[model samples]
Target: MYGGGYVFCEPDVHGQPDDPERLAEFEARIDRGEKIEPQDWMPYEYRRQLIRLIEQHAHSEIMGALPEGAWITRAPGFKRKLALIAKVQDEVGHAQLLYSAAETLGKSRADMVNDLLSGKSKYSNVFNYPAKTWADVTVIGFLIDAAAIVNQVANSKGSYGPYCRALERICYEESFHLKQGYDAFVALATGTKRQREMLQDAINRWYRPIIHFFGPPDNESVHSKQLMRWKVKMASNDEMRNQFLDAYVPKVLELGLTFPDPELRKDPQTGRWHYGDPDWAEFYRVINGDGPCNAERLSARRLAEENGRWIRQAIMNPQQKFTIPFA
Candidate 1:
């Protein structure tokens, strides 16, 4: 058992088991609370599935900084600026943790980073959008962080020991992120008329992206069954999305911010919030590299990499370093 209530299980190896009875015994052992260590035998598919999910998660954390990183210098006050800086730093730390987790699955971090930078991998769709204003940063902290909390909370019980432990640490940090944004939203809501207006506009812009962050519904989508059956994901995308709506919509209304959905309302009988569906086409477009700031974000990342390439080379190969004359 981990973190008091959840269990991490060893994945049953497929086909390599000696017999059907052995496979059943292995699965039965998993049904218990045993933890899956790195050296333990696991199905090839299980390793591949986890690599896919955790690598995407790491990439998301790294690229996720771009949207809010743009607003760091523009924060309204020194305190807010510092907070955003720390928050973005924490996101970078999350990337390190997740990438390390993925490394335990028999791949190198350098390879994963190369795949992400070269566009051979996908990150979260939410990061592709633009953070247009200072208010947009607050909204991102609140909504995006909140959605991640739901997913991370579910992942805290993951079968992989390292991933689950990393998620536990990440969840604690994310809670603080959520609270900081909540405080910011409350301050703006009670501030002058202009502040309120800006906050509302930010809410309008980020709501759809946050909703889409959960990805498409969990019907017959690709990778759904494999991920779910292998316990890589503990909750369905739509289920987690609904859980986010359940927690956040009322808080948004309490702050006098509209959710940008006219048909949104709570069902008296079932206690579930219902709203008009989001535009999946826009979600596809954004994930397909067509969002408002996709080009700018990628260019910034690429330029940073290129400008720092020499330093990386120097570190890896100190004897081959260039000798420059005094400036």
Candidate 2:
């Protein structure tokens, strides 16, 4: 036994064991930090659930690019343009990481891409909204990225080895994104009054989606319990949302900017940040493909996929003349 758990002893029963005690021992082994390899016993639901969760996350990452990627050409300055390009590139990299994680559950990255294109899968609701101005870019970087980081930081400790490892890299990139956003907000808040007003409007526009990004609050959320039990999700929707608010609200105020929420404040005693409830109706509308910019985002995604078809085919089915020797 190890750590109050069981271990297979001498005369290992690879073929002989059909006993209930052996099953108990196997479960105990898992509980004791033992690795469950490809051949290990597992319930069917575990695999299916992980595939669903990872595929959804992968779809989100890929689609997440569209909102911010739209701004790469319109960024205000040379530096901001380069930074936006770099940020979009990071999002592409994140999609790759997430797809690799999903592939471990017997799915292909191409298949997941197809799912997203065909509208058979869903993504983060935040991306469905419009990036209306340069200020929208800053808000996306600050509030949207901040909301994503809360969920991703929790995922860095996931039980699935591939996902946990991928999240470590994603979190590192997200940290940079968060800083870039904060810097943008600072620049805007400290600029002319017009800049400050733009920043505030952007904050108001994104605030609700950022709050709802964690999903519905406890009793209303169906999948939260199972997701937590499997360690696929570490924090409840409301818990993660609150954590994001606590980290950013003070910084927003320090710059003499105001978020739209009148009920928002920090409790000096409990040290918790409080805010009014998000508009769940709008959240549903966004999730159901009815957001203000949903059609445009999806149309752009479809066009990109369509335009790249020849390129993909050319790479996958290389002509004899294009073949190079590996030597």
Candidate 3:
């Protein structure tokens, strides 16, 4: 699944200044739809904000893999088991690509990883909820991945060069994930009564978090207009959420599934979705490390890091010299 919803906070604008002349050129470049490379002139705020967004995205991909990863061993058949493993592998690979993209902005991958482990940063809040059943995996693969594509496809148009390129590839791979997920979801929806019930339960359970996935409503978000001006944020959270609903709600209804939100509907004149509030209080709480699986997720990540230290040490050891052998 794609990582962040591109939920930005207000960037600190008081940092060191770039040359005023160079900065004007950079802004002009962005205005003219040019991509900003890593070594190119950029405002300090732009770099800081991009680092935060990309780092969170990288962290989200790996952490997002975990909940689904747990289901791999228990996947019902060989076909599913293989597909699930490949999907999870893609998610992890996305993290590597994203971290490398983030590194171009000057933060080391190690620093970002350390920040994630130390709780100095955050990933997507959607992953903090548990995947309680196999049907839940389908929900994540279908609905969650669908929501991510909306956000990512928008961000892919942003001015950042490497990050946008990385997103382009990631979005391509995620389309297949959506197909696999939708196939699984359709199977469950059309199968036995028990299967249908499981799918419904999963949908109900995930509806709120899916709504929360894109971050707060635009009016309440801490994001700055400067980010939008820089093309760092290509779409508002509310806009993306509406786009997801317009695209998916009918499909979901066609499957005989209902969202937990009773008031969900599109306005005739405005063509925008109107729904009850998704409980922003819960969103903030989950983001602050109070969600059902937050501790378990972080513990698993920490343990993995600790266990992998020896391999990193061995790879970096200056005292151990080795020569490549021909096959």
Q: What RMSD does each model have against the real structure?
A: 7.0, 8.7, 3.8
lDDT of 1 by residue, 11-38 (tens): 4555243455644654555568565667
Number of backbone clashes in candidate 3: 0
Model 3 scores a C-alpha lDDT of: 0.88
Q: List the residue pairs that clash in candidate 1.
A: none
lDDT per prediction?
0.76, 0.72, 0.88
Q: Which candidate, 1 or 3, would have the higher lDDT against the true structure?
A: 3
Q: Per-candidate TM vs. native? A: 0.88, 0.85, 0.94
Cα lDDT of model 3 by residue, 236-284, tens digit: 8889999999999998999888998889999999999998988999999
lDDT of 2 by residue, 195-238 (tens): 98898899888877777777766553444455555565566666
lDDT of 2 at 104: 69
TM-score of 1: 0.88
Tell me how many residue pairs clash in candidate 2. 0
Instruction: Name every residue pair that clashes in candidate 2.
Output: none
